[model samples]
Target: MNFPSKILEKSVEEISQLPGIGKRTALRLALHLLEVPKNQADNLANSISQLVHNIKHCKECNNLSDTEVCIICGNSFRDDKTICVVEDVRDVMAIENTHQYQGKYHVLGGRISPMEGISASDLCIFPLLERIKEKQVVEIIFALSATIEGDTTMFYLYKLMKDLKIKFTTIARGIGVGDELEYTDELTLIRSLQNRVPYSQDLI
Candidate 1:
């Protein structure tokens, strides 16, 4: 699609470069931004610029933050002994939305998928091991996706820490809280029953 203004075309092109954004959506967004107040557009541009320029990547957890340490890592109330290993910052955000976990996180950045040319060395696995050894992190919760890539990544991480006196567990995989048993897949239903925890009054 051709635009009257070259700037509009360029803006749409750049916006479309973002993941999951198509050219049409990018053009729509560019047009929407034009309709918004100048300051609003400026704020959006400035925020995106700051994400690349002014953001601080936490050395401890690789989380984006204003400081060297992220708020979660810096928070004293969070349990440091239990580290929830995840693939990316998005996973952290997803888990945080649940509000059920109070443990610290270790972002692997990406999973160990050879098809994607990503390996264990490409991730922050060494730092995790260092944290485990020096900080004495005891429990490791693999909160990754329940897929082939996620399973491969979890297995690789577990193998690395196998010698350490640490307890390793994957996030419980099964049907949702409100989901019907009949609607659930056979594998999910079986795993859910196998990893069932004792009934807790607090959970009710």
Candidate 2:
């Protein structure tokens, strides 16, 4: 059956579409918004609208940015020689929160999932290779998840960049299998990075 008001039902439906938010939670949120002051709701809506309108992917690393380049890429203090490769921008933010990595980042956009039809060509791998070729990158730290897809992507990247004389490493196995980098605690992430081992050396 339809709700008393179409607007309220529409608002609840829209909110429910958000990740992890169910219809009940969406209705609660919609009701809460209605109870709040109009100015406050307007400000919240305006912030989301601004985010949707202003934010864009960084040209260099594919991270979210308001401008052409992300803040990390634009920063002069970041170590240009080192690049931390991650599955998504959320992982980038997680690592940044630890303040353990002063180097720049390259968001792969996603991992390679052959079953899902996502391949090397589908991700930002080409741009990364191009960046490595053109820039003086000394090391690449892979901070992808320990999932099957994540492992496949890591191996693909390693093989692709093996010809280059750059040092490549992955975060230590402290993060359990199936664990996502974004969900990992700050201390654990920092420790994993600090104890990162050489990808090739560890394999042997």
Candidate 3:
């Protein structure tokens, strides 16, 4: 398709390269940006550019931050002894949204996927191990996605630390707190973290 302006074509091409954005949508977005005030467009471009240039990973947890340490890792109140291992900064955000976890996090950068040419060394695994040892981490909760790649990565880490006397656990997998049992999906039902009452007398 021919664009009326080469500049518009270039804008569409760049925007279309973003994930989940097709050329048609990119074209529409480019056109929409044209309707906006020049300063607003400039501000959008400037913010993206500034983020690209200034974004830094937290030296401690690999969380995206503008400083050497992310706000979570730098916090004094969070449980420093328990580290939640996740695949990326996005996973960190997802867990944070739950508001239930109070431990620190270790971003693995990505799971080990040979098909994608990603390996353990390519991730932040070594730094994570270093943190565990240096920080005397007492427990590690694997918060990775319930995928083959996620499992493969977790297994590899488990093997490496199995003899270290550190406790290991995974996030509870089950129905959401609000969902009824009848509406619950099968996989969640199968892998449910159900348990009997710890102190049955307390239920009375």
Candidate 4:
């Protein structure tokens, strides 16, 4: 059924391809965009295009940035001796929003999921090891999710970095099982960071 114009239908189809965007939501968004001013839509399109074309991974932490290094890596105010390892840039953003952390971040890009065919090598794990060797890092914090894949990745990292003298810690249990760090509230994230426990100690 061709209820809308060709452009509207095409826009809806494109929007529906985005994660969690169903046909109804896509159609609503397309209609809203059509009702908005031409300049607004053009600006939105231009911004998305620029983001797609210009953004690149940071050489050091593998975080998304427009330049070789991300702003977090380039910032002198952030603690250089501590690194918070997370599954993705969104997790970093979630922690940053809490304003309870002052250390640098390393985005793993993904978790270790054998079922999904993602391995340890698929993530930026080597770079994280290299960063620890190059920097005067004193600690590594695991801010990964509580999912099975996240746990597997954390265990892999712990074993890999066991020879190093740096302290290892994981975010506290406030973020319930099966809960994603990205979905965690600001207060809960902050409390989790503050109440982080040593991974080794918890194991014992």
Candidate 5:
């Protein structure tokens, strides 16, 4: 699209690079930002800058946070003996919205996908093992997506800790096959978590 100013065109180009945002949407956003007060635009830019530069991953769960530890990890009342395993911060947010789980979390960063060259070693699996050992965790809830990669990751984790006397469970089939946890509605996610079943190879 032709632009009256090279600066606006540059802004649209950068914004369009974001996921789900096309050039037209980016142009509208750029125009909106241009029409807004200078301080308002500056605030938006500053927030993005802070998000990029000041964000830290929680040392415990690897979730995004502004401090060393995330608020959930720091909470004294969350179930310390139970850990919910998820793929990333987005999954964590999806579950947290349900407010049905009171346990801690272990973010795996990503699932094992041979096609994508993502192996167990590339994820946060080591830290999870250490957390289980150190905390004497009793129950592990596999909250990964309902896809081949998610199942593969869950199976790998189960095998790694099967002999440790810890209980293994997975979210119920309320989540459809090939569904990502992050996209599941809160009601379905809650039901799935509430009706979780013992982890079995058949489920995989």
Candidate 6:
């Protein structure tokens, strides 16, 4: 597509790089931004800059945070003995919205996907193991998405931690076989959390 201005073309190019955004969508967004007020665009630019530069992962659970420890990890009322393991910060937000769980969380950063060349070493698994060793963790609730990669990740984690004497459980299958945790409704997520079952190799 040809643009009258190189600046608009550059904006479209940059915006198109974002996930799920096509070139046409990016062009429309660029035009929309151009039509918006100057300060509104400036605010959008500033927020994006802040998101990239100011955000840091929580040292404890690997969740995105402004501080070393995320609010969930730092909360005194959260259950320290039980930790819900999730794929990313988005899953954390999804579960938090349900308000059905009171345990701490461990974000694996991402799941193991051999097709994507993402291995166990590519994730925050080491920090999670270290956290388990340091904390009085008794139960691990696998809150990963109900996808193949999610199942693979949970099984791998189970194999690694089976010798640690901690109880292993997984969220119920109410979220659907291929559903992502982030996209599940709050009611379904709440029920899944409430009806979690023991994690066994046979279930995979």
Name model 3 segments beyond 4 Å from true: 180-186, 193-204
Candidate 4 TM-score, true structure as reference = 0.81
RMSD of each: 1.8, 6.9, 2.7, 6.9, 7.0, 7.1
For 1-204, candidate 2 gives per-residue lDDT tens digits of 367999999999999999999999999999999999999989998999999999999988999999999898999888988999999989999999998899989999999998999988889888888888778899999999978899899999999889999999987766766799999988778878887777885444
Count of residue pairs whose backbone atoms collide, per candidate: 0, 0, 0, 0, 0, 0
- Candidate 4 all-Cα RMSD: 6.9
Q: How far in Å is the alpha carbon of 179 misplaced in model 6? A: 14
Expressed as tens digits, the lDDT of each residue in 106-141 for candidate 5 is 888999999999999999888788889999999999
Q: Give the poorly placed runs of model 2, Cα more than 4 Å off.
A: 115-117, 175-204
Structure candidate 3, residue pairs in collision: none
Give me the candidate number with maximum TM-score: 1
Candidate 6 Cα errors over 4 Å, as ranges: 174-204
What are the clashing pairs of model 5?
A: none
lDDT of 6 at 40: 95
Model 1 stretches astray by more than 4 angstroms: 199-204
Residues 1-204 of candidate 1: C-alpha lDDT, one tens digit per residue: 968999999999999999999999999999999999999999999999988899887888887789989999999999999999999999999999999899999999989889989988898887888888877898999999898999999988888789999999888887788899999999999999988888999755
Candidate 4 local distance difference test against the native: 0.91
Model 1: which residue pairs collide? none
By TM-score, the better pick of 5 and 6 is 6
lDDT of 3 by residue, 1-204 (tens): 788899999999999999999999999999899999999999999999999999999999998998999999999999999999999989999989999899999998999999999998998888888899998999999999888899899999999989887999987666777789898878778776463236676544
Q: Could you tell which candidate, 1 or 6, scores higher by TM-score?
A: 1
* Alpha carbon lDDT of each predicted model: 0.91, 0.90, 0.90, 0.91, 0.92, 0.92
